[model samples]
Target: MRTSTFLMSIIVLVAIMCKNVVNGAIAEGGWMTYCQDKTKAPEGALFACFRSNDGGIHYNGRDLTSSVIYSNPSKANEIAVVLQGHGASAKFWTNDHTVQVYVKDGSSVNYSIKPRQGEGRVNSSVYSSSDADVVIGK
Candidate 1:
């Protein structure tokens, strides 16, 4: 009886996890896949961005569009990405807010909900590396 109870508990936990993954609980805010090589971006780039809408989730090169076009202007070899809540920056953010990309040249780019389109706005800036860590947030 104890073994049966433990097995039932494990099954329940697995079911909940599977449901969350399928329902975008893992993607509640948004997610991005970066180009391993920034020099060849948006070209043969295995990239995807997501934004949740009332209608449903919109993906880059699909339904949602990015106003901030990513070009490796500095010719950096790799790009650093920060999901809205996953960064070590001090920024005010809500769920489903923004994604931030950083390059080594003290430059940063932010992607957030379009104005009046969803829930937040993109505020991007540049500062000395000592003063602030590279960050992207809504």
Candidate 2:
């Protein structure tokens, strides 16, 4: 009984350690800067992003839309009007998923992947249907 219990504990510990290693690798590989659809993600994978301390813009659809980030399927909660003094924005590209973002100051953009339910989309006035980076409308 003691041996079995010890073995089980070791297995659990190993699992936890392995998860951390994988998460670190993913973040280091730039998974932190993009958004991810959790359902399609690996079992224990986590997304991470880099934050900037420069300057950011807060935006609203009507009058508050300056330097802000927007998404398609337009949801108020999904956009960024004010990104604080952090980075511009970050995006992550997964196997079959990709999210794109625009920044006023391209170098300042820093962002991470956000887990969402269903399909995810961002909308903003800057997103041109003709732009090759996006695919929601096409």
Candidate 3:
């Protein structure tokens, strides 16, 4: 009986730890920053940065009606952009190192980060449509 109780306790503890790990992997609690240069953006362009709870940063943008999602991992100095059209959804894993962007109806842009560069320093050329031009910088 004592062995069984100990085994159950161990199982419960493991379950609790696994739950916490899974919860922490989800993105939560982030901030937003507008694009530095708005003049070049297309009509109704909106871009901002969101800081996740896991120390990663998400850069989301929209122009004319299309949207883009970009992320910077917490442990690396690289940037990844995932572009999707309106009503489309995407998922970015924390361990991803490849750069990806998807655009269906409108347009999209690619971003690159210098090695060892901090989040405050980024270089990217973004566009959502034919008339949209978004330049992101410090």
Candidate 4:
């Protein structure tokens, strides 16, 4: 009887975890790369940028769209610009780390990622339909 009870408890725990993942309550740490500019920056630093898709979830329990930029080779310094909306598109500057992101809800954001700064951090900005575009550089 004790063994049966333990097995039942384990099954219940697994079911709960599965439910959270399916409902987008848990972050899978997966991102889809939208653009990668191989061009080198000043001081011979290389940078790569990525944008999140519809599967991402924000900390506030809303749909997430983000642009992540990191230093190449080491990836020691990184920055993330996130927005709370669906449908995101990214455009990168030629031979530079600057990127502009456009959200489907008539919202857009831009950022410039620096190299060898420190740990990665997320910068969240709020926007309304009237805002149209937002820029957050460096």
Q: How far is candidate 3 from the true structure (C-alpha RMSD, Å)?
A: 16.6
RMSD of 2: 16.1
TM-score for each candidate, following the candidate numbering: 0.21, 0.24, 0.25, 0.22
Question: lDDT: which candidate is best?
Answer: 3
lDDT of 3 at 36: 26
Arrange candidates, best lDDT first: 3, 4, 2, 1
Candidate 1 whole-model C-alpha lDDT, 0 to 1: 0.33
Candidate 3, residue 53: Cα displacement in angstroms equals 27
Give the Å error, residue 53, model 1: 22
Model 3 has an lDDT value of 0.36
Worst 10 residues of 3 by lDDT: 27-36
Tell me the lDDT of candidate 4: 0.35
The local distance difference test score of each candidate is 0.33, 0.34, 0.36, 0.35
Question: Which regions of candidate 2 fall more than 4 Å away from where they truly are?
Answer: 28-138
- Using TM-score as the measure, what is the rank order of every candidate, best first? 3, 2, 4, 1
lDDT of 2 at 106: 29
| Backbone collisions counted per model | 0, 28, 3, 0
* lDDT (tens digit, per residue) of candidate 4 on 65-99: 44333222323222233333245433433222333
**Per-residue accuracy of model 1 over 1-138 as CA lDDT, tens digit each:** 999999999999999997875443122222222333233223222222222222222224322222222223243212222322222222222234433333222233333333333655554453321222232232
